[model samples]
Target: MTTNRLWRTLSGFNLSTRKWTQVNPRKARSQVPSNLLSLTSWNIDAFSPRAIARAKLILDHVLHESKPPDIIFLQEVTTAVRASLLQDAGVRGGYLVTDAEDQTAFENVPFATMTLLSRARFAFGSDSTEASEDDEVDGEGDLMIGRVSRMSLPSKYGRDALCVDLIKPAATGTSFRLINVHLDSLGHTLHYRAQQLEILANVLRESGCGGGIIAGDFNAISPEDEGLIDMNQLQDAWTALHGETGVEGATWGVGAKRRDGLGPGRLDKVAILGSKAEAMDVLRPGSIEVPRPGQESIFLPWSDHCGLSCSFTF
Candidate 1:
């Protein structure tokens, strides 16, 4: 994508520090849908068929259940497999944006390793477009250092990341920005990760979207990992809406890997920006469910990572 075109896509961005007057608490709407929106985020480890099946089952339940989510954001999608899986699971509308290589030469980058799937419209970043005058051989050689492992064939799969914008129906007048990302699992250090967060922060500030939601496998636990993002600019929707702060909130480790309890800490997350946090009707980190039998519990193993979902009112 040309610089000019990229600027066009980011036209709404503004650097002004002037903030909008937050609506008073008394006027806010806190009663969200009783069933809550069912949104799930799973790593779906690439090259592992087991993880794929686990991810599919989660989707099946969400589609089958009542009070289906208005949107779903899925990460770690290698290609268009997520869309196909959703279709097979009976989801009616599917949209996706994967960072597949169209280059004839080889390069390496983690962003090229996966894709993002959502039941929303997609707007890609400008860095994805290629110009005819570009030198292919030189570009390929420069990207050799960032190559994604496990692939015999090499291409420009790791250099740049992809950004997708998921839009709800315009008639409904409800929308948000869904960013699916897999930060450098290697290469760049802590500072680099922080820089990645900064980039995202700036994007939200500029996009001027009504409600912005970012969901992904951050690859780092919150409040502990250095350079791991500080939730200062955004609030974990589950924590903010539920008013709980405890260890059980973790959402990783289930399925084939095998975990005894709720797994090891919360790595996957769904967050709302402070700019729009007040709009949330209700948010929770677990699946919406009903108590059955004498079990007296609504817990059921859904996937490797427990899903997080929320509802926002305009």
Candidate 2:
């Protein structure tokens, strides 16, 4: 939890600009296993009603999935949610967290942002003394992190992609990136979200990994948002498995209480730019019982936006 050592059992970070610019203090291991890589994306709505209890429920639901996802993406992560995630046993034991608290690395000005939980682990270089203080590796060579960094995106609400380099060193000698992002939310058209999507796609394209995922709250309220996939050279998991108009694929306004008078919308999404998709569904943590001052109990959805879950080979 110290400011200097992230990925060291949830502890340092560096500022990455475009690509994998950070020196590979620890070389990537062999190519990723030919197994289905699971992913989940959600905007937890940290600014709304009961954030603390919802944070706990969110943690319990994701970590205990019937088949837990390899990578989990969460948006609307307030300081309280981040702190709870850090203190949780499942997060500390199962995933390597990003340093959202550090301004030098990731932007901390956003009222709510994104956090990535990855189960990918890496191997260090031959020399034991190769790691410097800033290197986010453990004493042993099995480093659970390749590198944790972020890149700024154009948003009126201060949005950025929380990029994590998964050390699946392919035979071609290029590792892939798993980026978590919460794109701009104001525009009714794809104007703002389109710009953000392009930037995320650019990062994947520049990496030459050909196989990275940009999953989070895309705020894809517009119909044209689907075309952005072709525009950005990426594949959408929703369309791949469930098709365009599958009611089951809807994430937002589904399992939650919506008073906006809006019908169920698939706002949260997972777009890949994958091995292949095996299964896909929405995370419906029906409701939580909140103890009131004198009343018996009240039920509420964990988030205003239901989380999206997808599984594909890597």
Best by lDDT: 2
TM-score between candidate 1 and the true structure: 0.53
Residue-wise C-alpha lDDT for candidate 2, range 93-164, written one tens digit per residue: 555456534434334564455454443444333322232224345333233344555676666777767776
Give the clashing pairs for model 1.
1-129, 13-206, 77-115, 106-155, 107-155, 107-156, 108-147, 108-158, 109-158
Q: Global lDDT for candidate 1?
A: 0.39
After the best TM-score superposition of candidate 2, give how far the Cα of residue 160 lies from its true spot, in angstroms: 0.7
lDDT of 1 by residue, 1-314 (tens): 11111110111111153221111112112234312233444555444334445556666665555655545555555434543452352442332323222321113322123332322222222221221122122211111001111212111223223343332222132234445555444333444445555566555455334545556655554344422444446666656665554445555552324433333655666566633333222122233343566887554443445555555432
Steric clashes per prediction:
9, 4
Query: After TM-score superposition, what is the CA distance of residue 267 in candidate 2 from its true location, in Å?
Result: 0.7
Q: Please report the candidate that would top TM-score against the real structure.
A: 2
